[model samples]
Target: MRYCSIPCRVVGALLFGSVAANAFAQVGQQSVPLSADDNAEVEHVWRFAQETESRSSLPRAVDANWIENARLGTLKLSGCAAALVSADGLAVTSATCLRSLENWIRPDDSVFVAGTLLEERKLPGLTARQLVEIREFARIEEASEDLETGFEAELIAADDSSTFWEYVWRTYGDVRLVVIPPADVTDFGNEEGVYPRYAIDFALFRVYDGQALPLETESYFAWNDRSPYVRERLFATAFDANTPFTVITLSDTFSYNGTISPPHTTLYGMLDQYYSHGATGAWELTEDWLSGIKENDLATALNFSVVGECAQTGAGLINVDMEILGIAFDNANTEEGTRCVVMSTSGILALLRTVLKAQGVADELAEQALP
Candidate 1:
């Protein structure tokens, strides 16, 4: 019901399409009363997947691919999520991760993202920087034979379609990560039934070697060339709100094409994992531009889809199958279960390839065997 063992710091959402339109909206403008947990005092904060006091006990806890995925690395945005896409240091994530003008108010706003948006979000002098730095994609042992070369990445381009964005890591990195969420956070909204898979929340990056060259490692996620079918199992991973690594799964084949009521709403997808939080939206859209209140911002992200159409865009996406995170396999069907929704892999890949083409590196994509 709540989004965390940790507290929720949901903020007001500002939704605008064309800068000329200047369409503004707010989420739950009515002040939500903060519970003791919501308003808890200062304490330590370690991001997801980063070292933590409790990490030592979980040794052999995650797969080596996870480390590779980690090695592929991640980009730190004030309020967004991202991951390494290639060994040469390409990365991918939702194009709208940082689309929120509200997030650019910080002093470091000039750090690089979108240039034009910066000007729009701020004063005349503000220019956006697309490139950002990525730290370790994975951890190498102090004594490991492979040396670690810390590198910085550059943001080359983002597709105009907004379905996916692309960046290149100085070097490349990639690894298939099998995730097991255990007790975690899914934020797919409490007791809500609609699935939000409209953001087209995906991106691509090229990871280079430490020397800032093309990556040649065997550790990349193959393009999964084959189209996804209903009722198939897909493993998906997402970096946590902070240092945690999260993987969620779809228990069975779910659909929305013409099945659920309201024809356009009611997507059938659920996280086969456990999460403490409910969903958050990039923009809450509906038949009317205002019905969506914090759902994923497909309107802004893709510049398509009517506002409020993807009204439950918690963390910008909900998709695909198999519950892998935790050792706690009770399957109680308790409310604690993660209720999520995701777009079909076929669809995700189609959008991704478009970004790849724009980046001129479609060949860099791994070869997927037809299923």
Candidate 2:
């Protein structure tokens, strides 16, 4: 049940929020508009959608409307990004991203598993922000808008210049913890820099409105129970952890390698070297074709690529149609670069169904049409 292919590096939990982008931006230069060839590396969701719309006919790829929907469903957490999976405000994220919840649990209880809505615990001061609007301007002064009720503005400069982006976010502070597996299950092996992992590595929470009821959300990513095939086209939408502002969702495309069965259905892919050094982050999109996947059905080999190492926990792996394939929870070091290990949605749905059924709420989760 061990990963035959060993990882050189393993990423720890990363949190990104509220930091000003001025430190990461070019303080004295006018930011330039995204060029036509800006598709390779990470690009802002708005700019990426603009490019997608301009394409005459790109089959099986996301369009501007798809990007808008994804932006609305994504929530920026203090530790990582989470996707709204159900219309009733249920969100799925990496268990590692929620280690802070352990502090709230009783000291004697090793893990916190809320069996029902009544068992869910409120996390004080924890908030999740959803992007409501994105506005771009060449200069900061050109950006002026009266924020709607319950919305807040976050001004951020582009990568290297004064060009400012005003990101309006709707903050939801009444987030309640729903479920989290034990640490041993979420982080199997306890082996750093190892892969072909069998870890389920996930947690769930529900966002509540001021009335303390589940927030009704029109925008969300439906669960895709099928596992992704190798060479399948996929993309990720998440905020860059190194950036000062966490509201801007960056989009990047990559292909998935076949799953390694036996120990677990682990999805791996070839990701470029995207690592952050302290406060600065690297965004270059370069793939190493030389890195090949090692297959083993009896055991398993775990090695995959993801958008970014830090602050990417809980980011969703989406297809062109905007369906959720899996979630990025852990990263690994390979000869190629820093790659990620993704827990397939099929497996996640199975685990969640088991938990909900035990809690006598399987029917509630099944209503979402998740298999």
Candidate 3:
């Protein structure tokens, strides 16, 4: 979640915007197409997109505060989608990102989180906690209170069993990790039809804000308590290429929900959406809409990454953030594409426990996995 540095498409554009209303009506909700239907659901869809797109796309407008909060979920990837889990700066993204950087992030060559062929540095002390800043070939003195001190990180945890992940870890050294998680898949296949069915593709990071402290904000996603079931209503944030807000169904039409279920995984995302680079990380959020979460003590998390063709993977997945690795499904009914996949929420939590244990950060993780 690496392409040769195109690591992968961060977020697959969920089937919202454009003709999404029509689709939603067919399966989950009623239609709100611009041509007709003046109702709450339709208006919510229109307004969410209009207001969200207004934040960055349109500078001078009724920019909503919620948009700023939504930004908490958006993390900068080498073009992939990533999510901020802790206000103190812990984030997560698909481990599949490494598959794209198998060539660049190696010990023998210069290492970098290459976003767009940007300037890079070589840090020998770059461990899992963070990236070290080397100046003039010397590790710079870290300020005692500098929260932004670390840039590089170590593989906190990953499916250690996956050969692709282990090989990349040995080579490029896990570029975006502040820590690692064990994994079973790494670049097994990034193609829309060749998604990695066996890979546990999630990874975590501890980020430092510009002020050198944890991000100074009150907006961060809280992990949901249980796994999402099939056909749940999903709401997500989108990248520049899509409408700011996307509303879709969990997609129970296919056999995806049962694909990677287990102690290794559960709860995958399935949807009919568009796949593109700008859409990556678009859905790396909790919930921006009240409609998605019902009034209950344990409301299902509407936040998650949709799987699609990652430019990084050269491919497809409808990732639900850390929940499921995501897989893309295509059929003749392709309005754009047939389906998108995601990881299971419970699966991510299960693996995260292993990640924390391996990183020796188990004691602090209860706080870390929270917003």
Candidate 4:
């Protein structure tokens, strides 16, 4: 299926126009704080909760850091910014982030790099590089009425008045933007088998010429791709609404499971619901208890859906570690409410690691640092 409704520009203009007047009126207002009981609930589902008890937490922290570093040169594409995963420049971001980059590049062009933080500077001194394009492990495609889609994108161009030097000195960085490829697909035959069902929906690119590099900072997370198990405590550090660069230990591992599905679709998986304080472009995964449905091997796959008033065509769903889980591509509004559906993360990872390993760059790119 193809999208034939209003163009995104028109929709954005209408949405922004409707909300622009109220932007500052409610700006900086924090969401209602979770009560101690609520906080306990959050802890029950988040990955960070178990870190204090788990010795494996160190490697997971490294993995998080590696994911953040890789995002350096990449544009947040969606409202959610990219994070580094590797010290050498591998980035782990939502698959939806690639949509904007794909829109910006020419279809015939096989290679493109997006410049982040550097877009506003007039300086010819900073150079941009086009690194190899990494194949995405998943894509957002049009789904049938019975099927739902979950994906979203945000484009962040530098404000013209901004300067690279000023950004580097005052904000702990310079930024650049680059273009990458688009990865979207839909359609799986029963014959493909359920145990290894996969989707290719994320793209990889690089950024360079930044000051106060991520490696220089004391803040960062570790990588742990070798062993992924459920109930393993983990942490997530994201830019607070007030301070874009200030890292805070937001949440912990609530619960998790790691068995591959044998066949058939799984249902009722829970994801963590971390509070988002009007974070212009952020998405949350449901609680972990809900995600536990995948523990059984007979379920070869699963799907995600968002319950809200907004349309689902472009919403994004991600893991607590900020890995791209799926994209919102379809929705259904009922007296119960609108439920936006997304493809599952297991599908994407299966395809991504396979392709990355084929090129002999999966591990390196997954652990590379931002240049």
lDDT of predicted model 1: 0.26
Error of 4 at 207 (Å): 3.1
lDDT by residue (tens digit), candidate 2, 1-371 = 11111111221211111111111111232222323233332234344466644342332223456557777777888768888877788887877777754366554653565777788888787788888787878887877667666679877675554466677889898998887765645654453543445565777789998889998987777666665644344455566444211111111323224433232344232121122212122222212211211121212222233434434778776654456667778776544345566666665555545432323333444455432
Give candidate 1 regions above 4 Å deviation: 1-78, 100-196, 207-219, 227-235, 241-243, 253-338, 343-345, 351-359, 366-371
Tens-place lDDT digits, model 1, residues 1-371: 22232233322111111111000111112222222122111111122235444232222222222333332333443344443333443344432332332233344331222212112122222111222222222222311243335433322211232221122233223211111111111122322234333333343333333343444543333333232222222223332342223322223223334543111122122211111212324222222212221232222212111111121221222111111111110111222333344333233333233321221333333432111
Query: What lDDT tens digits, residue by residue, belong to model 3 across residues 287-336?
Result: 31112212222222212233222222211121122212222121112233
- Winning candidate number (TM-score): 2
Candidate 2 segments whose C-alpha is farther than 4 A from its true place: 1-42, 52-60, 100-102, 142-149, 158-162, 242-311, 355-362
Could you give candidate 4's per-residue lDDT for residues 262-325 as a string of tens digits? 2213322211111222212122322331133233332323443333221222233323333333
* Deviation in Å, model 2, residue 170 alpha carbon: 0.8
Global Cα lDDT for candidate 2 = 0.54
State how far residue 161 of model 3 sits from its true place (Å): 54
Write down the TM-score of every candidate: 0.36, 0.67, 0.44, 0.34
RMSD of 1: 18.8
Query: Each model's C-alpha lDDT?
Result: 0.26, 0.54, 0.31, 0.28
- For every candidate in turn, the CA RMSD to the true structure comes to 18.8, 14.4, 17.4, 19.3
The number of the candidate with the highest lDDT is 2
Candidate 3 achieves a global lDDT of 0.31
Clashes of each: 85, 4, 71, 95
**Model 4 segments more than 4 A misplaced:** 1-78, 108-182, 186-199, 210-220, 226-236, 240-353, 356-360, 365-371
